[model samples]
Target: MSALPMLHRAVLAACLLSSIVAGCARKADLVITGGMVWTGLSSGRAQPGAVAIGRGRILAVGDSAAVAPYVGSRTRVLTAGGGLVMPGFVDGHTHFIDGGFQLASIDLRTAATPQEFIRRIAEYAQHLKPGQWITGGDWDHTLWKGAPLPRKDWIDSATPSNPVFVTRLDGHEALANSAAFRAANVSKDTPTPPGGEILRDPRTGEPQGIVKDQALGLVERAIPPPPPAERDSALARALAHAAALGVTATAHMNASWADFASYRRMERAGRMTLRVVLYLPLEQWRDIADTIRRQGQGDDWVRIGGCKGFMDGSAGSRTAYFFQPYADSAGYYGLLQHPEASMRAWIGAADSADLQVTVHAIGDRSNAMLLSIYDSVARAHGARDRRFRIEHAQHLRPEDMPAFGERGVIPSMQPYHAIDDGRWVEQRIGPERIRTTYAFRRLLDTGAKLAFGSDWTVAPLDPLLGVYAAVTRRTLDGKHPDGWVPEQKVTVAEALRAYTWG
Candidate 1:
């Protein structure tokens, strides 16, 4: 062979070797391997797969060998250990700051009896200073045998020094100790405000400490507000909770201006661990719109996008407006939080400003009314991506089910409510209405988008628990071994999509 031919062959082999090394040496900031990766697409599993991430974005996701090239000296590798790997969950609704405060405060949601409830308050009060008010217990009376509302008399002696104003698990009603009432100047003679009810003794006509709906403000206004430092701490705790839960984003519903300021401060300081979309109260829609118009709807990490309102109160409190009176209280239909005309005006104004609107509608009447209002608004405004949502769309009339999909409305639902509320909801509304309650499968079949959330503080913050509830429909009380309204149950994948993509 000629010497020239040997030299050319050697050069060609060197070039090929260099090309192979270059192709196998790409860098990644992080790599996750050994997982059953559900790409979250319609296509099924990516078994024994790996993911490569770079500069805060997914660089590659495929077979483990395919992603091996992106691993580098500085890359952080996480092993899934045969567990499922998918997109981080997005909570469609949350009271984030409130959840943080709940984490730090005494939790009474698990209290089983009246005595237990009083004992918990007594213990909690001892930890606080005399002037410091005790709040945020989130007690649930439904756990008790009779489901009796707590009275001031029950906790007055225990919370003598510290004024106590604690809410129920639903946050719609609250029990105020005698000290709190005196501090708020709420007397037996104090007339119940419109859209609110101050429960009084049947014979004595004295305030019984159980305040429902708008009446909660009567005592809440008197409680000292938390200082800015405390608020910041709570916000930080909530952010940490979100990160630990594998939640990448959350929509904060019914946040105050102070909450918005705190979120901005966190973002500015680079302390935010997840994305937040703040929704101010519907009454403040004009203010939010002005802020958005001036500053422009903010960046991905912090943005103002929607307004939240309430058509009625929660079912547990018996304030969820329904088409017919509750079974327990004949001729006593639930109260509407706002007049129909007022709701129309507020919704119309918000719609005109091009802000997304989400209203808390729990009962058949409230849901139907809101649907009508939304339909009217859509007809007048023509079509844009309004994405108007009904938070907690817990109960619905069968006829109104199709409107959600037809109108392009989103049902921002919390699956945990079905199992939690199932224990005794039949007693409140009766078995006939239970068919369409938490109709997850029915809504999806009708083409309505389902956005899942935790409604934290009212329920568990974990999305996995939510998925379990949706898929199983088994009541937490173990009464329904098979399922509660089994026809409404949805698949695990469907629930996951609602928590993530929806």
Candidate 2:
């Protein structure tokens, strides 16, 4: 057997850093074979393969015979067997730190009944100290039998001592307990903030404890934030979780300053296990611009040059800024999170500053208007690599679908949402609107770029689950055997590319 001299891992790193590595032998640090390998090429085809990796770089990738030379005495070989060997996933969207905390928090995502929902929260609260804030439930009202929006009263007795602030899986709405209300000083008379609403009881006109969109700050502000160490620890768990799933990098779609600091500190300390592209809130475009000027968008390990804006809320919350009223919600066409003019101005300013812009637009009208804003912004600034992205472009009008490709705007979407939301979306939007919802096939046909992610903390962090959801379009329930919207179902290869290359 041919063998190459073994070199230390540190020497391999030096060889990778410096072009001249004549002294260092060409040997693989890790080798994997015996599987179907996807190179993530334009062809979207998988080949029987082996891969040799060295110094955190792909030294060789081909059929077993091709990469055999790279295998050396020190090479660590892993057999994939019949499994798939593909490129590391690039999660296009995530709430990284929050996802970590949620990993250990109460899970109401699968609570099939309102009783079970309360039960989970109540049981989880039993372990917490009195007056301690209970957060990160990620409950879905749609999962319940009647799809009832949970009221604070429902869980008030259950969590009498704890201040509870549990959000819907979509993160657009939340159920805050009475304890939370008192802590936050949120009374029935408190005026609701624009772009948000505090739901109230129809009979007594009392606050019902359901907070939507911007008004969420009322209760959220009351809950004490995790300390720096805790935040850092959460980041560590999230990174470990992501790496375990073969995720090499992530794009934190709506990141906090603390999240960026965590990533920066980790990268500086060589604790960064995965890459991060931190996109700050778009409203602070000026700050993002200034930071870019000061830090030069950081290195590839942890970049920070993009801004994310919100165009609307989610469909689950009936706040997706649609063109028409939801079938279930009378006279409600949903609402935008920000005024059109304000969004346009901020987007234009950010474009002028040359920061990548991505906005959340889940409704058809929201996507349309945001597209127009992108078009106008790009036209105003002339042409460069703007790559304007529409995060959660979940619903699109037929006409606006073409605009995504024509205008070169990317639809940064979560495929898991297709399956999860598909379970109840028809009741909300009706059959007519459902045709265009999560229209991955048509969007790809239009030559639009697709960026798929888990929206972790909102959905599962596993990209494999996302791939299954996208390829099958199967709802979480067993009902959709064929698929939820089978016609819109993308191929495994296509979905894999979105999870990796995008």
RMSD for each of the candidates = 9.5, 5.6
Q: State how far residue 197 of model 1 sits from its true place (Å).
A: 1.0
Best by lDDT: 1
Give, for candidate 2, the lowest lDDT window spanning 10 residues: 1-10
TM-score of each: 0.91, 0.91
- lDDT per residue (tens digit) for residues 1-502 in model 2: 0000122233333433323333335798998999887766647787787777886776666667666777889999999996877767888899988998988788888898998988898899999999899898898888777878998878888898999999998899999988999999998778989999899988876789899999988888888888888888888899899999988888887888888888888887899888788889999999999988987888757888489999899888999988889998799999888999999999999999998998999999988999999998888789997888988899989888988888888888899999888888999999999998999999999998788888998998999999999999889887898998788989988898777666
Candidate 2, RMSD to the unseen true structure: 5.6
List, residue by residue over 160-213, the lDDT tens digit for candidate 1: 888888999899999998899999999988999877899998898889999999
| Runs of candidate 1 exceeding 4 Å displacement | 1-28, 44-48, 64-81
**Candidate 2 ranges beyond 4 A from true positions:** 1-28, 33-35, 63-83
In model 1, the clashing pairs are none
**Per-residue lDDT of 290 in model 1:** 94
Candidate 1 local distance difference test against the native: 0.86
